[model samples]
Target: MTLTINTDVIRRLRDALLAEAATGAGAQDAHPHRDAALARVAPFAETMYLVMIADGRSAPQEIAAVRGAVRLLTRDLLEDADLDRLLDACAAAASERGAEVMLQVLGGRLCANRGDRETAFTLAAAVALADDEVTDSERALVGDVAEWYGVSSKRARELLGAMQSTG
Candidate 1:
């Protein structure tokens, strides 16, 4: 048996592997923290939107609040079309998985970071009060989110109050 070694083939393979590595590294470097921040906030947005739906209806204001919060949190990292797509996906997930699953995901994500949990609670409160009044069911949902976020009831009240007053 005779062995044939082609330098051109070896060089081409090495170049391809290097190119792949560079491409991956470039993507990772492009927006290192943005993706992570978006992932952390997304569950909370979906959970907040679901809270409104818990009463069997999602008001336009509630949906708008979700869109605004997701937009504010994501900022330049997402385009309008991209935000709408992501929000739609989140809403679908909530609809398919049910409230318990949504709560678990929301709680897990919020618990990962204290600051995020606080901000999430504030955002949820805003959504709850978007229509100018929080229904009994919405109140209960907000309470559940606060408890899951480890926010004291009093503090939750204070945060919700501040958000309401500012609005």
Candidate 2:
């Protein structure tokens, strides 16, 4: 006898896991203002995290760069533990479903302001180039992120180039 796992079942499990991470017992706001800041930055963080892991591997350099970018963007409004938890949640969600689904979920609600979009692009590019190399999938995912958030391809490429130049 042979047994095959169902994709739908896996998808459902992933959805449930993501939902729980969003509102489960441990997910609590320490302060209203801080929570508000986190809320604003969460989508950006998630988007970058997805891009970092798009190549089916997460390097320490990428993780560190993403965390540093997120911390700078959030301006210490979110605690380190909370930020890690949020990134871990994003990783779990993206790993379970796939990059497109993760991007779609984030695309609907991320980076409304011009600054936010620029920041998102910067964070994605930083993570992509953290290890001094950008894989094809990482490049495509960064473009996908730019497209989803209504950023022009020209601007995205420029941002990536800027990051490369600085480093």
Candidate 3:
């Protein structure tokens, strides 16, 4: 079987995701805060591209779905100072380590919000798995953050395993 990949389709998927994230379910005025938050992530647009390319072969529809889901999840997970810091960190990191780093920073913010260090680490690990693979460095970063968040080493490993399996 041959899977045809079009870069344009991926671009559209990314735009759609940003659009969906920009607009709420029912409201039409637009969520300024959400817009601002999305703007922060805007710098890492290439990350989405990288994820698509890294997958080797992907249906445009699949790309669209993932983009939409990511936007929704991000919009829902962040708020207030957490959101601000997340956006700032993402913007800064985008210039340095690129979008993957942004994803890791996001995971950290989510973990901080939940106050459940283990879950946060799991979520971050899961995000890394979004492209169907996680680098050793990414895993190590997740583990380190998990530890900083007060997750036990064993529990962090267990959660990472479970999340990766499920993902």
Candidate 3 segments whose C-alpha is farther than 4 A from its true place: 1-28, 32-89, 93-116, 161-167
TM-score of 2: 0.71
Higher-scoring candidate on TM-score, 1 or 2: 2
What's the C-alpha lDDT at position 120 in model 1? 73
Ordering by lDDT: 2, 1, 3
TM-score of every candidate: 0.69, 0.71, 0.40
Ranking by TM-score: 2, 1, 3
Per-candidate alpha-carbon RMSD to the true structure: 20.8, 13.1, 10.3
- Residue pairs with clashing backbones, model 3: none
Q: Tens digits of per-residue lDDT for model 2 on 58-162?
A: 887777666665556555456667877888788778769787887777776764677777667666766676666677787778778887777775665454443
The collision pairs in model 1 are none
Residue-level lDDT tens digits of model 3 in 9-114: 3234445554554553432344667656565444233233333333344345434433444456555533434434543453455557754565555445544454
Query: Could you give candidate 1's per-residue lDDT for residues 1-167 as a string of tens digits?
Result: 01111123323332333333233212223355656756756776677677768677887766666666665565445445555666787779877998777777778877878777877766666666666666767767766787777877566655544322111
